[model samples]
Target: MDADRISKLPDHVIHHILSFLPTIDAVWTSLLSRHWRRMWYYVPTLEFSQFGNKDVEIFYNFVDDCLKHRMMGMHHNTMSVITRFNLNTVYRGRRSKVKLDRWLSFIAQPHLQKLVLNMFEYEPVRRRHYCLPEVVLNLASLTVLKLVFVELEACYPVSLPSLEYLYLGHVQMEDEILHTLLLGCPSLEELYIKDCDKLKSLRVSSSCLQFLDLSGNWETFTIKVEAINLQSFAFSNTAWKKPCSCRFDLASCKKIENLSLHGVSFYPDEDFASFISGLPLLESLALDQCDLIDIRNQHLKFLDVKTVRYKDRDQANWDEEDWDKVDWDEVDWDRIEISIDAPNLDSFKCYTKNLLVRFLMNSPNLSETFIHVGYCAETETRRREREREWIIVLIDVLFLVLLVELLMFPQVFRRNCRSPLPNVNKLKVEMGGYDEDGVRDALLWLAPSAETISIELEPF
Candidate 1:
């Protein structure tokens, strides 16, 4: 298989295959010929951009002639360094911030390991950021950092001893320079702070942090987390305009195992069940657009709840005639009474628009139950007979039940619905807008012991 195997490799493996192309195809491999002129300047990953340039001074003279041919090819490759430098710009003024601080002090090299700065605002002017350069906190061989709309300043013996993955969007630090940039990244492990609103109050003392994503700190005034080997935690302040008297303290996270809260609004000195019972290894919990009254956990298996369509937040600050002066059919379906004593709960997924969710208890290790409804479940035909009598008294012992999926939109059904879907081994019904008298009243109230039954209808 050697038909001139990629021009017979080895110039550092063809500069690591042109460092994964595109710096305009790695400068068109120097017009491919004389053994590929200068091998794309010993590529070790240098990405520049102006995305589909519309003459932003020819992308600032093509990144100033590719950093002057990578500093004159470092006098003929003296062990070429640059290990990944991505700069995504939209051309700001002041000579593009002095050529982006002279191309980040010419890639503060120590063999830089992954750095991406995405400065946006591609034209409809007035919104300039980009302020980070104390030689980029002295990049001591960084290990993955993505900052967008930058502006962070903290000059204090910052360390960075081999940083490990940090992503900050809409950044603009100053909470003591974000606690000296997380105490100078001591072996940081996956941190993503999104939509940063100048971080009001934050403290994440990490000891090799596992993974933490905190979103849009609206008026964040308290988020003191002490990661004791944190294993996945996510928090979202749902674009805060109100409901964000922020306070999230992950009680010294005891090896948490995946917890996600979107549009979070937890108060009362933040005792969301003593921070989820001190995370005795939480399994999985996701609540979108908050407000799930009370949830008890015993190593939760998986629970997802969705409901909070605040006009899809910020549709240009929504005002399509104030959504026709609100009156979604007198708007009140009252059913936010949720109480779960997760006795090793298996799986429960729910997406609602007309609330009415009542599962006080009884999921003897439920197998899988997914219910998604937006409307027309016959306008809650008497709350679907008390939600099918508490879903057959919550899966009568779930004989290792397989699957039960139901998604309705325009469909509606109501019938005697005798006892059959108890040990649901498989039953699926998804309809967006259907009529056959709504799948014959959802097959006469879906009595399924399941020998396989699938009904999907969603066209229109």
Candidate 2:
């Protein structure tokens, strides 16, 4: 009955509603009314990214016509109306490259605030890539730049005056080119570098950068960041056996509050302690498969360590001779030690392999404690041999203490805290393995306070 109520809305409200719909769908709404036809021109964001199985030429023409019509609708004064332009498609050959270049050149206006160009090769049999045009750097008004599967070279100088956020994933660029790009974006506040194989080192000294994420490049030799205003930082390397020892030099980032490291081994080991000590404002820290000889932080509230053992060829860098020198299976668990000192820590999560753990300070603020401890051996015989060893008993005792601390308010397990089997608190134990029932039965005696226990087969 009130059909015109939808169309009677203000033009600005209509345009805002249309902005969420796909650009093609928004254009189809033109048939609704004369008022709706004109509203499409004011929908500031244009996204053209549907290229599933359609003919490449048809897709290219569709994008071309859409841009042309949007440009024609705008008078000379509306040249800078389009603020966001996103084009994601599978680029095949030189023909796709030409169309992409034309689109980039068309959108290189003074008011373009955000630009995303994600071109991937859908046909795995015939992979093709596009060399990013130098004109993209000339977008002085652009505040965010996200590029995926594009190749960049230092042939052209970089210039992005207002850019604050930059994300480059699966991009191919040399170390010098990446450095030049970082240096050019003076106002950049957030930077992310992922799966860029050519980048060997990341050295960011931007005072304005507030967030930084660098990961997925296994060959990266060093990471040295000195952003004084940085609030969060994350670094990851999935590969286990690396060619060179990974070094993270974040000492100058004094204002950092949150930090994460995954699969990144620390060299000179003591550097891990110094790194945490320097970040006085840190509130959250996560370490995944990273070396943790010592973690001493007074301001930390949440800490998570996922030290799961993963044995795969992908984790191996066979080309490096150093990888063959040490056998991971034969690593001495007794020698592996972790010392933690956090007074105000609220939550602690530890999923570790065989390692000696010692909490130097009683975390008075801790409210939650989760510990998953086990010794993974190469074979069933070796696992049984290890289960009979003295460490297994110690591990059971440690688990009981960890659960007791969880139930009690003030931690009873402080420095020099030790107990064997005797416990008092509500505890739960869950095990995942083929012999889960057997494993649970063996460990239940050590945790008499355990009120709940569950066992399931290992998913993997």
Candidate 3:
């Protein structure tokens, strides 16, 4: 009774739909009907993933046979252009390299716009990086290329004039090879390189580049970038290092709008406040597990900071060899005294177990503020009380411990926030191990004008 309306779609539409399925599944669709018998031979995209197959040779054969059929179809004038191809498998031996080379060479055509080669092999005896085949030397038409766990066969430069996006993860390539490869891509816009431990020098000089993300435990290196039009940059590394290894010079990227960093230690020469002030167009900033001494900016609108204290970190999984390299007395990691001065800031968030963030002036335009503090006992309380007004930030940090400290003596809270927060309309309080009467007095002293106050606590 059904006329198979969907199957009557145009050839190009059917090919587009089949592009999302694995090449094997697309080929198996030939069994659906006589009309779909040879449809897969013309699909523009092919994806082969050797995930569930236990027999490596059988999987290799399937890929080889599939490509052979495609080549034959092209000879017969039945196949069209292939714009994208994704192949994920393992490289076990010389035969694997030969097969990979054959496949890459066949697909390295002017019409191939995107190519992804992800071969992740897990062997514990001795980790080794696979060599890239020679055919990848020139893929002029590729717009996007992603390679993981593969190294260039040689230190020769390759050409990719049309490339706009490139990602290399766990890729073993010399600093010279990487520098030359970046130079070859004149149109590159976004580049990401991560977890490639073999690199020591990072040099990216692109006029049209917009975004760059680099993450790894870079022990010591010289990093240089000359991207005039860059808008966003991100760098992340593991924490607990006293002094950062790499020194940076980002004076060329003046157009940056958003920045995120983690586990980066500022050296004596690199002033964080000066760097923050230099970015006039910057609007958003986020720092995680990074040193924070002082920050002063006028145009910022959003700020978020998350810091870690030495007592809060767990060193159970850290490599013993690496742990021995750290000097515990380099600096008092427990003393986290941070100062922030942002007048136009609209949103602020601070999450920490033991750290004090001092804001010089109140955030007049602040619409949202969230502060969750934990594990600050008598020692931390005394250090904070003796060091800071501790009253200026009472309006921002509503943690139970700090509140109890400031609320224990209600006069300090009243004098500092002389006027309750007039903008606070809804308030919620959770109390434990404190008298309800003291909690009530603190709320009245802090936000007496709050229209609605919700309290959830156990009677002390």
Assess each prediction's global lDDT (C-alpha) against the native: 0.72, 0.73, 0.74
Looking at model 2, the pairs that clash are: none
Root-mean-square deviation (CA) per prediction = 20.8, 9.5, 8.9
Off by over 4 Å in 3: 122-125, 239-243, 311-333, 355-364, 374-393, 396-442, 445-460
Ranking by TM-score: 3, 2, 1
* Model 1 lDDT per residue over 204-249, tens place: 8988999998887474457788989989988887563444665777
- lDDT per residue as tens, model 3, 1-460: 9798879899889999999999999999989989998788889999999999889988999999888888887888645678899999986756777888889889887789999998876552455556886567578889999998888655466888999999999898888888888888999999999887778878999998999998877756567889999888888875335324556668888888888877777666788888887777778889887775467778878888887555434432245575456443332335466666677777777777554444444355555566656543245555454334344455444441223444444576477745445456777876556776777766765666888777787666
Number of the predicted model whose lDDT against the real structure is largest: 3
Give the lDDT ranking, best first: 3, 2, 1
lDDT value for model 3 = 0.74
lDDT for 356 in candidate 1 is: 50
The model with the greater TM-score, 1 or 2, is 2
The segments of candidate 1 whose C-alpha lies over 4 angstroms from its true place after superposition are 1-94, 106-138, 141-146, 150-161, 170-186, 193-208, 214-229, 235-254, 263-280, 283-286, 290-324, 332-339, 343-359, 362-460
Task: Report clash pairs, candidate 3.
Answer: none
Off by over 4 Å in 2: 76-80, 122-128, 240-244, 309-336, 353-365, 373-460
lDDT of 1: 0.72
